[model samples]
Target: MTLIDLTPAPAATARANALPVAIIGAGPIGLAAAARLTERDIPFVVLEKGESAGAAIREWGHTRLFSPWEHLVDDAAVRLLGASGWQAPAAGRAPSGRELVDEYVAPLSAHPAIAPHLRTGVEVLAVTREGMDRTRTAGRSRAPFALRLRLADGTIVDETASAVIDASGTWGQANPLGSGGLAPLGWDAVADRVAPALPDVLGADRERFAGRHTTVVGAGHSAANTLIALASLARDEPGTRVTWLIRNAAAARISTGGDELEGRGALGARLERLVADGRVEVLDRFEILRAEPAGDGVRLHGRRAGEAAAHDTDLVVAATGFRPDLGMLRELRLELDDIVEAPRRLAPLIDPNVHSCGTVSPHGYRELAHPEQGFFIVGMKSYGRAPTFLLKTGYEQVRSVVAWLAGDAASAGRVELTLPATGVCSTSAGGCC
Candidate 1:
């Protein structure tokens, strides 16, 4: 697995420092990191598998964000875009994912300072140290990082960098619908019957789910948001039914709000009321074990109260949240939490059992570092399987990381941001952060 030969520390640092920093993904976080590097005059390259920036978010553009534009926009990006006459959107108005790309991501990516360094349709297949595999230890810390890239034209190439910042998000790697953290029986054949999280049920996907029964499997914000949209669709389209599935004995996770639109999160409260009013059906303690195609629909087989239970539905929405695709980092040295899969030091703070998207305290490079030198995983990928990442938090992360890379320890250690103390979004339409 080794490529370039290893060298001594002083010589390796001198040679590696001359190489550009490599950033994976061109999403908001990746581009923000690029902006920070650009502001510091540090040479960097951004590689995105998508042909355009924010490609993943574009898939769910119909969903509206709860956070205002002020929180979505990165300070370093703002400074760079502002100089190019790019005016910020009104601070208080929340934007849909499409609007976010149009009003922010596109402009930032097109900025004179960043456009040249942005490489679209470039996918990074793997990341490891030059002349080193996961087993090699001596002088591994001093070797430059090697990246295997798949280009737009299907050509493979090798690239190296002084530092690697993985802002590649987890939006593409949604978790399975099975109960035991793996795909259910017959998943391979009936996979098409399953839908991703936050499907545009009211708009783009109205035809597919209009009069069909959908079994939504999950207890997170994405599940609640999809339920709201399906409920709304049912109002206009007859025969539209939603079956809420959960492994827990009770649906306590979605009943956060106290029967009223409180000061904090309210999405859960709306969902609770809907369930109470019989607008949606609940199937708690149902652990899905198998799924098979039954006619044009799908048959979900699971256990309820230790007994066999099965349900036939036209579609299944697996809003089970996402997990970081760490397959590419097989040769890297990483210390991640056993449960959440987040960086070890950051796991406790962002773990779902203890922290919420808005409550996770502001942290920086130190919390994101790996045993492999100059490698940091930022953005939603930093949270691993936990669905508790905010865009602003990603911005602050890169700010600290870039500062540390630039030899500014003081700025890297300082916490300059504060987050809202609430949990999930206040509106049902607001999906994951």
Candidate 2:
């Protein structure tokens, strides 16, 4: 059966009475919000900066998730998937990024709950109040926030919504490898050699390193996946040397999912084995001070966390981290948290007293909403400097925002969903499920 009607033409005029909600980021969390909103019969639209669900996943398609399928499965996400007859794999293993996106995120977006509202290739630049609506902008009126978006095609559209959710992941911005600025010491004369955002593990440019020395920095899952993938190509491509430079004495590894070792848990073990096999060199607790020009390549200078000795490398891949873009909110009159610029207090259900999705920290949710009633930050960016809770937080935000918009303060306070514990995948074989 067709979940949505489409005859290649617009249908007859119908009252556009549904409440408008705009979700930024089409990843798991954004899609999940779409699903939840759809289930509640809420009318909304999803704007994805990337071309598809899990673009970051597609970038690292060769890599497996740190969490297993069970942990990966958000309750709402699973229900939507099930409705489409998408059976959960039984082995309970962590699937690769591609598999997770294709089988889960992409499929879920197509579900009846979210399909009509899913719009890809749209990048949300900012969320602010509607013009002349200072009452809502200042928290005095119950008007929703206005969203200013720039699509991939360069189209600028201003849309008003009862709420705004930001699910854009930390992966969008790459934390630079240099401190203060590009290391002033080495390669300063030819800084162009540095590729700010290096290609993802499966990026085409990665192929040029086939028979050369390469150094990878940072210790997150992205870095982990890159090391493993490069190691796998060693046998097929001779003279391919790998060096891992992490600040930790030993890599921090997290095993994820099922009885099978395919998740982050498995990758950690695999990395250890690769280290033992002498396929990759591990440089723990060191830092790069500068990249000095050396004959043909660059010599990297740095000291260990405690030691003063420096190190060297031919190529560097920094997987530091990311930060959010506050371009749209820069000039807004709303109060911003000193750190993250997110509304200090956000009560999605429209209640003036309740700040449901403010800060998920020891301080609880801060009062970022100010006196303004309609403004809200609904996704990962909402967390600001807070340790990102990932998709779970976004899901919670939307639930509260929807309730708040519906003017049910009591219901917003009562809205809570339990997330699955991490690990527990259905496929554990080969650790690349």
The lowest-lDDT stretch of 10 consecutive residues in candidate 2 is 1-10
- Candidate 1, poorest ten consecutive residues by summed lDDT: 1-10
Instruction: Score candidate 1 by TM-score against the native.
Output: 0.93
Tell me the number of clashing residue pairs for each predicted model.
0, 38
- Segments in model 2 whose C-alpha atoms lie over 4 Å from true places: 1-19, 132-144, 180-206, 248-262, 292-297, 302-312, 332-397, 408-411, 415-433
Q: What is the C-alpha RMSD of each candidate to the true structure, in Å?
A: 3.8, 9.1
TM-score of 2: 0.73
What lDDT tens digits, residue by residue, belong to model 1 across residues 1-433?
Answer: 1122211122347788898999999989999999999988899999999999988878878777767778788999999998878899997777888999899999999998889999999999999999899899888766899999999999999999988999998886978878888999999878898898889999888999999999898887678888989999999999999999888977554547442214224767778888999999998889889989999999989899899999899999988778999999999988888888888888988877765566778899888877776888998899898766777888899999998888788888889887655433322222243
Estimate candidate 1's alpha-carbon lDDT, on a 0 to 1 scale: 0.83
